[model samples]
Target: MSQATELEAPQAPRTRKQRQAAAIAEAASGHVGWMLLKIGLLAIVDAIALYAAFVLYTASEWVVLGVVVVVAILVNWIYFSRRHVPAKYLTPGVIFLILFQVFTLLYTGYIGFTNYGTGHNGSKDQAVASLMRSAQERVADSPTYGVTVVEKLGALGLLVTDPEDGDVWVGTDEQPLQKVQGAGMDGDRAVSVDGWTSLSFADVISRSDEVEKLSIPFSDDPNDGTIRTPDGRSGYRYVSTLEYDTAAGTMTDTKTGTVYRDTGVGAFTAENGEQLLPGWQITVGFDNFLRAVTDASIRGPLISVTIWTFVFALISVASTFFLGLLLALVFNNTRMRFRNGYRILLILPYAFPAFLSALVWAGMMNESFGFLNQVFFGGASIPWLTDPTLAKVSVLIVNLWLGFPYMFLVCMGALQGIPSDVNEAAEMDGANPWQIFRSIKLPLLLVTVAPLLISSFAFNFNNFNLIYMLTNGGPRFDDVSIPVGHTDILISMVYKVAFTGQTRDYGLASAFTILIFIVVAAISIISFRKTKALEELN
Candidate 1:
């Protein structure tokens, strides 16, 4: 009776106005800080969105601006609206998945079908400007103009005084030399312009490299010669040896009278197999893929790399699993002493980063100064990382050291999880240890481990870090034009093709990546299907 009265005392009766006033006061007292925080965060987001909108508009990136505006509006609506309960959690994940995964994959696929390499990276206008600039040569009878080296916003420009009329001009790499007023002349040359700062003699000497390299277009027309200063004091008129016919879509060599036509293959080629570089990107569908098999220069090396990749992945998975399983079995005895200490010591290599471990092993495998040769082999010159066969052996050994600990962990857990009754029953039936393991425990272990082995194989197949850090795909193949070696796997080959050379073949690398993806996916699917057979052991 007392407890009931205590509970009922808090519900004391009151007037209608008093109840309404209490409800409003409770709400305000509890939520004021949280409301203020939400408001402040929203204000910050609005400010950032507005700033981004202004930048995108100024850059004339309309497609990107529209996307930003729509995303900002959606984000605001999702957070502010009371009806959007689940969208707040799912929106961020969906956006990141689309941007990082879907967009990257699609862009890479698009690149695989195009000639987007060294000389074919940018747009048509940039390529045109570059072609004209590269072929420019000094005209024999060109006029000499007085010029002053000037700077604006960290960019170098030329302040030119026309030799004939004495008109002052200023221009940078992106800007054509044009007439400007408000010139402050030192003697006969316009040293200082209105919007540019004239460099002192000391400054010109300090930035001699930049001053020598600076070439400003004389005007908008490509036919007109550029203004190039030789000693930062005198400018000369240089015209391009190649004349471009914009309307006719042709480039003619002024010296040889060879007409180069746009072959629609990203380059301008002449009739005799000559090509002018600085070409723009163009799509050449399936040519990159076909070159992998059909082209003589790439096919042999690619085939060898593909074979080595398979062999390396297969050997790495098998060796690591067997070694780890052996160690786990030896240490799984209940009566073993100091087994925990041994286990910790074994896992030490795994605790460090894989790339760091590979680097350490690379140093330790050096023939002349390595710990293995000096301390163990009595300074014998063993080419563990140089010879073709020894390099493969070294890679496998190092991979075994780095990979066995993870397998040991998984195999240990899987072995311990098996029921003791099954082994006891097998022993009671007069079965030997080997028979029991082969028939009973091993089958059960496979039920859990087969999927993991497939994943490990896939990982080792694309193990770029080990190859890159250790050998850098060295001991180059002498017979092939492609920059591949005996130690180079498919992924490493792709990396070298795309980045290491003077001509980075991004399209071919992307094609190789797609092929790798298809191979791995197919193998994984088939192996997963085979693993379904192992479930019967469960």
Candidate 2:
């Protein structure tokens, strides 16, 4: 009576738990939740893909459109079916890799071969439209119409009232003038329309440039002219002063009869060597790359910037690694009290964001009314960020402050992982602390740390944020045509060329980028080979 049966033994508890788990599983399997979740996610993915396809189709990107459509169909098939289980896991990453990495790289390389700059950024049709628009002038004898600037669906339009016939009409850049029946009018001026909102005087003033640029077509044909307004109240007809010969690909000035022919270099040029701008994009084989190396204005600055970049990366790595190793050695001792607390303090710089830390240091280093000038130097005005030499020094100092903690953490881990027996054996062999570190510990440390040091060098090589945020690559070079500075690296120089200048020379910048990529790849390969040699020492 006191003993339990064999069936009700210690295994009964686990059996009961198993039964409960099975019951829960059976109930969960009966629910439609898992199916609904899968369907919902698939629906979202399909919707996004369809939207992208529609945009690509409208843009007439046939090759990319075909690829997208095929990919979308494949994705839907893979996820919905039980087959190709591995494909379901790999599809998302592969698609993202193609779209973001492969597409971007290809597009950039294509741009490098072409004159894809500010004036030569569009297709031939767009260039023609722009040229024609630039040649437009108001007809002196054209009748003025009473107009009210109105907006429909965020597009500017003219709600125009005819003076002679008193007919109300509305037109935009795309739409030809059309009758607006039953429209509210203030004598001769159109006050309101049913579907559009009239812009207030303040709104018109705020959007002055947009209102001035708005050209409402008077008729279906472009030759019929468009009505433009300077004040958004009165409109007058204007016609282009240039006529394009579509059959022969020439633009003729209507008044002067000067013919501009397509030079096959993007611009339409006259025989006397004048060119009409807003040119179409055209490929120029190796011209951009040649310009970077051969052009006198760019070549000299490029050489100086390249040298500075190498020096900066090398010094930054050396300084940070040495300092970090020193601190790590000091704290790694077992006899040292409060080692953990000191380590936490040592890594405090790492805890804060690097960008924010750079900014704070920037303020402190400011020549005027800064923390260092006012407090430490007694308002000495040290010109930390202004002078060329001091600016480079300031960048290095800030980078070391921001960078050393990472090196400290890495070196600390490497030092701790070294075997205690190795250190003890070196001591028994009559080796001093320095001798042990130089011969045994160093070789061992290099085996683990060489790869990381190479990576740190790579990171410092392209360290754009420090150069940009701290100095903005300032103390500008007086002799250069491009915007580069004493502290400017290759990446920053490329940025200034592509974006800061009046002409946004994307092709030249891309060419420079290709050069930079080649340099970095070569360095990484050679350094990695050296790192492999260190690994053999262990």
* Best model per lDDT: 1
Write the residue-wise lDDT of candidate 2 on 1-538 in tens digits: 3365765666635688898998778856875787688789989988988988888986789998898788879988998785898998999899899889998988889889999998999998778767877888999998889999999867889998888899999988767799989888888788899999999999999999999998876776555668899998998988888777777788888899999999798988899988898998999989999988899989988998999999999999999999999999999888999999999998999999887888898899999988999999988989999999999999999999988888899889999989999989989999999999999888888888888888898899889888888988888998778988888999999899999978788999899888888888899999998788787778
Each prediction's RMSD over C-alphas, in Å, is: 5.2, 7.1
- Residue pairs that clash (backbone atoms under 3 angstroms), model 1: none
**Clashes in candidate 2: how many?**
0
**Regions more than 4 Å wrong, model 2:** 1-31, 141-212, 216-236
**Cα RMSD of predicted structure 2:** 7.1
Candidate 2 residue pairs in backbone clash? none
Give Cα-based local distance difference scores for all models.
0.89, 0.88
Candidate 1 lDDT over 243-287, as tens digits, reads 888887788889899998888988778999788888899899999
- Each candidate structure's count of clashing pairs: 0, 0
